[model samples]
Target: MKLAVLIHGLLAITPAAAFAGYSLDVRLDRSDGFYKVGDETVCTATLMNDGKPAVGEKLRCTVKRERDILRRDEFLCEGKAVTVRASMDRPGWLFFGFEIIGPDGNPLQGEGIFKHRMKTTIVGEIGAMYDADKITALDSRPADFDAYWASCRCKLDQVPLDPKLTEIDVPRALRGKVKCYSIEVRCQGRTPVTGYLAVPVKARPQSLPACVDYLSMVWQDASRTVPAEMASKGVLALYVSWHGLPTGKTADEYKTIAQTWYEEGGKAGDTDRDTWFGHDMYLRVMRALDFIKSRPEWNRKELVVRGGSLGGIQSIAAAALDPDVTLAIVSVPSGCEYNGYKQGRDAAALYRGKEAVARIEADPRRAVTLAYHDGVNLAPRIKCDIYVCTGFSDELCTPSSVFAFYNALPATTKKFMSTNPRTGHYGTTKNTAGDKRLSDIFRSVTVYD
Candidate 1:
């Protein structure tokens, strides 16, 4: 399939102002930055001072195969743009990143040039993907992948699913129109599935379609209290938090928990599949689906799952693990093609290359356990209509890995993929149009009006 046209038009100059009236603009020979294997991709890097070409400026440039460095050199901006050419023999990405350096071999200092806290000093980048659709998971699907997940389902079945619902205040406009509550459901894990549920106050039994919204990885409290405005259109909306921690907790409480998670990290229990952190995460996903289906107000005809980044990962799991899910919308999803780094592509799991490989090599069980959770392996069983949005510029969940997941989906599954070349991860840039498109799809699936 050809790259989305909407993505080609999204590329533009960097939005931030450069320091000391200096700016760097990077561009690819082809705006979309897609190429066939063995095709050379050229990146033009230009430096400007007060909107004019900064002649005689020195640029330190590096070409990388994902995170692996390939070449590093210096170029002179002699009243024109300097070019760097790179290519990949296999399906993957080649990133050409450059920064302005002074004659003293030190990076130029200015207002936006140095961000101490972020540890990111690079000024500009051009990312290119070669034969992206041809990329696949480095590791084969374990033979027991199905049997393992089936056992997880059976284990979750034994849990009581004792749901607790507490009425909560809604925005003034929704006071009479919508009934909102804080909901918790017991599952097989140490924590319960917790989130906010919004239902139309006047809906009759089996009247409204259901939507389960997954939040992106959250470390602090945010306004996850309300559903999209469309929830009032006769949709039963459940906003599930990834961490089963209480909703609306004091800031300090959340801070303490986040610190603990940060230090322990997501890979804490990966050695054994049964105790792997992902095991409990999937359990919560299955239980959340159960809780939504249990609602008397559910129409029993339509169920939608939607999220971005980490939430996207869970959304994929939800649809794959449950046959009831009719639609899934995900963007910039991580946790895909977990072992891709072994093939020189970036790993989309919680850890990076060497560390991730070491864990798998150290224990045969880890390899099997990770395959069970890899999105590429799970994509084939989704069987639901899917809408995926990705950013070619995203490093956390690289475009190559996202494409691998998309390619793994069954040919008969109704699906669409859209992208923005300028957006990265989540906050680096926003895809307003793509977001609206996804919202429209969600509304179509659940909106009663």
Candidate 2:
């Protein structure tokens, strides 16, 4: 390849997304995103310096495994191609990376982060962290799981949903007669639930449907997009924060508040039912639901709940606890099959790590207490139509745990799960299939009532 021709005509110009100065890429052998377990798949890496292969450059290529395996060679990359072979004994995802050696004896900015899926079956989602076919969730459900949650629900019911709303000015373009408010509603404990609530302005109070979009771990999320837009469609919308911080605060203020929660963040919450974060989270969500349906504007029959990551956990828990929820969409959810860590199957097993495990092991009863809050344990109780979306390459929320959660749903419950092989936790691309499914879901929602 001619260097001038490649630089001037072939390489696409970009401000930032590509590698800083050099262009690098890697492609695996399989186009369908699958490899038979133990089958060696060749990963070919290519680096272009000003669009021409640098004949004498040294590079490092690696595959992530139980322990990362690193290989370096100058001759391998000389011929405009460098091949690294990888195979996994178990069905799972593989991460491959490439780097060019810099003059300072450090790796350069160019990198190839292509991934692969090793599998035994030609069917189903590939690159999953655990074998979907062989997945089994350790049953951590406490014998008193039902009785305990029932008691919790009763406690939540006692808290008066003294809902208060402070109206906010909507951008003129979004106003269109829809009203938005910063909402605070009392819940199971004194912390209270906080979020944005948007309802359609009415001549007299009018009944409406509702949509719930729970939030992620990010700090101050502004805008009342859900409820404000849904108002146009005759649906009430609520987006609640998992942490009970006042909505509409400045982003820096929210950041300061969020840092304080870090003191309360971790496995330390596993002492018992009252201490667990899940306990507060779910009860608050249930309370949010109470506030939603209790509105004179509530149609009472239609409720949609959804979110991704930690928010997904809230969505699943809300639908499980509230029979009024007509639909639940959980994407890349956490809080599922935590016990998979014990078996070395949870991909991000080291995330919470040993000290967290020690807390659970400190008392048998504490482990049992966590069982009541596991998302998989509550899945069977969900009565609504549910859709689960997971990424095969998502290490944080392992797809196997998702499969366990999905498979445990009762036979009578209508459900569907979609997985993309290439995407990681936050990189879910715009997928046409996903769009079609979502269209079908809300499309049906309009008619289900």
Q: Which model scores highest in lDDT? A: 1
Off by over 4 Å in 2: 1-62, 65-82, 91-93, 97-130, 202-207, 347-351, 362-365, 427-449
- Candidate 1's C-alpha lDDT? 0.75
* lDDT for 318 (candidate 1): 94
The CA lDDT of each predicted structure is: 0.75, 0.64
The root-mean-square deviation over C-alpha atoms between each candidate and the true structure, in angstroms, is 3.2, 8.3
Q: Write the per-residue lDDT of candidate 2 for residues 1-449, one digit (tens) a residue.
A: 10010001122212123433454544556543345566776766666555556567766654553223334333335747677776667654555545566577665541321222222110111232324444557787878777888898887777788888999877686665678899899986536789888876661244566778888766776358866766655567788887767787887888887676644564445667787655677788788888888777767677888778887888889999888899887887888876666755552222245566666667876667667778889988987878777765465677667777877888788876665544546535222333454456445433112
Model 1 lDDT tens row, 191-282: 78988888887778997788888877766432345463446866888988887778778767877887776434767677777778766777
Q: In angstroms, give how far residue 83 of model 2 lies from its true place.
A: 4.0
Q: What clash count does candidate 1 reach?
A: 0
